[model samples]
Target: MSDRSYRFTHAITRKPAASIIAGLRAVDTGTPDLALMQAHHAAYIAALRATGATVIELDALDAYPDSVFVEDTALCLPSGAVTMRPGAPSRLGEAAEMAPHLEALYADVKRISGPDSFIEAGDILMTETEILVGRSARTNAAGIAELAALVAPWGETVREVHTPPGVLHFKTDCSLLDAETILATRRLSATGCFTGYRLIDVAEGEEAAANTIRFNDVVLMPAGFPRTRDALLAAGYDLREIGNSECAKLDGGMSCLSLRFTSKP
Candidate 1:
């Protein structure tokens, strides 16, 4: 399998706005500190830039409290990009806001215009061979089907899977560590959705660490998960731990902070 799936040349991130305190969450942990969240956001962008990739820093969209979780706006692929129709009522406008940005970067960009379809990149994991989309409260069958049809002509295959009950997004429980290896929570891996791939189970109770991203040579994960950190180290992954306390309150993780992709015009 090609490493292009995780190897990115460019990334796009939005600064966390003060309104992020109102960002949607399955449960309210606490109000996010804008200053602290900005600090963490800076560190994240730095880590991505350290890989020698160009990082497009977009201005904050305060009107949308959940805009910082940019991954839900679209799926960026080698062949093209697709703007999603977010299920959350407040998040719906976020997708349209992201479309022009994607158009500027991608030569061919598409949109999930089905009125009833709803998909988020947070619920979609792209592999070297196929795109695995987990059905979640934020992503539905119609959205998955639309995505499949849009990418079919590009030689991409979409496989629908089940996200564990109450999971906010598919990636809330798993992430691709490499072309053939996956870092997943036992809760997600146990579903047998990844039978063919190598698995690295996150340490018990450290399931939040599953929502990590393998970018270039480094794997970025939220800080505070010592056991999961040690396991990834043992596996020889170059890991960078970033403070995520603030974003965590809003159910945001490393993968949610940015959209990583390589596009050629």
Candidate 2:
């Protein structure tokens, strides 16, 4: 199994902008406080850096309120990086903005050029053995096909799957814990997409905790899901809980703030 899946040496994150109050959302629970979100973003970055990984912090793009969720902009693999074509019109340009940054770090950077292709890294989960893509409103079959074609030469396998209905992204309810273990929500696990992996279901009613990220030695999860947190702790993961209430107002969470990867210059 490739440790590249989770043992990353670098990560890229964008600061949350003041315009985050205008960020897209399925339902407006409340306005996101920029100052609070920024504080949370800093904590998130600190957690990533705590793993001894170099983090590239990018300036915020006020033009795109949702630009803070950099994971949706591209897919980073040990082989190369592929710029995504987001389905949301407002987020489409965010991918292009991330391409140059990726190109500077990866020798083999590619893009999903099909006009009809629409995919987001947030809909993708890279495991030790394969790439699992959950088709969502932001990710389509064409995007998946393009991504598959782009990475096939690198010997990576792509497995198409379905995101739970109503979820913003496939990863909204699941995350890879390690080579063989996954932390997921029962609603998503019930689909049988994770049949072969050792699965840890998030505590009932704490489904939001499913979007955690296992970065190197620490598993970064959002604060406030004690039941689920305790469960992960029991499983022996080094956990760090970051405040995500502000980002959560926009349906964003732990994994959405950054693009984690290890690349050869």
Candidate 3:
């Protein structure tokens, strides 16, 4: 019921630029079709609005190829917003670009500023009482240290979780389904990072489905994963499937598409 939970009231998303065709991809899934990705991005913003959030859609940043993934720029906490120090050099400018919008909605905005610190919000998982951070190649110790300090005053605890190899982010392997439930892959589940939560396992061969995002009452999942769809339906969730084939090429998922927050803009 709190802002730290899935009951979001506001969201921030950016339109994907035509330059998104050149977004960084780990395995060379080939360039995404610009027109198709834009259509998908539109539908994603619509989905966020349907969740009852006042969605703020920013103009596309043509200069930044990966600017559409706005969630990586900051962590929206109930108290304020914390700008992230992106691990990817190409994405470093995104934090500054997202500042004006965040400041307009939030009165307080903190940052992780260190010469050696690098953290992407994609590596941090938020819950009602605690935050699980991934010590991935993109997120370093200094970044985690900074986050722990900012959230401590709000009565939130930060715990570090070991990320599996070959993943771009911690959320690439799992996502929170609800307040007490988590949807995760077998690989990440074995890490024992979610020992206290009720975990719902994704269907075999549907590991990518683990990245679904629960906004308010519905879960926005990636389309084309039938087995995983059945798993979520069986779990009693009202689900909405979004096309993500194009975004997946750039290592993005449902959670990376927008920054969901409860504060009114």
- Tens digits of per-residue lDDT, candidate 2, 180-245, equal 999999999999999899999999999999999999999999999999999999999999999999
* Cα lDDT tens digits for candidate 3, 172-258: 989998888999999999989999899998888988888988898889999988998998898799999999999999999999999
Candidate 1, after superposition: displacement of residue 55 in Å? 0.4
Candidate 2, 95: how far from true, in Å?
Answer: 0.6
Stretches off by above 4 angstroms in model 1 are none
Cα lDDT tens digits for candidate 1, 166-264: 999999999999999999999999999998999999999998999999999999999999999999999999999999999999888999999999866
Provide the clashing-pair count of each candidate structure.
0, 0, 0
Q: Whole-model lDDT for model 2 versus the true structure?
A: 0.93
- Give the better candidate number (1 or 3) by TM-score: 1
List RMSD in Å for every model shown.
Answer: 0.9, 0.9, 1.2
Candidate 3: worst-modelled 10 consecutive residues by lDDT: 1-10
- 1 or 3, which is superior by lDDT? 1
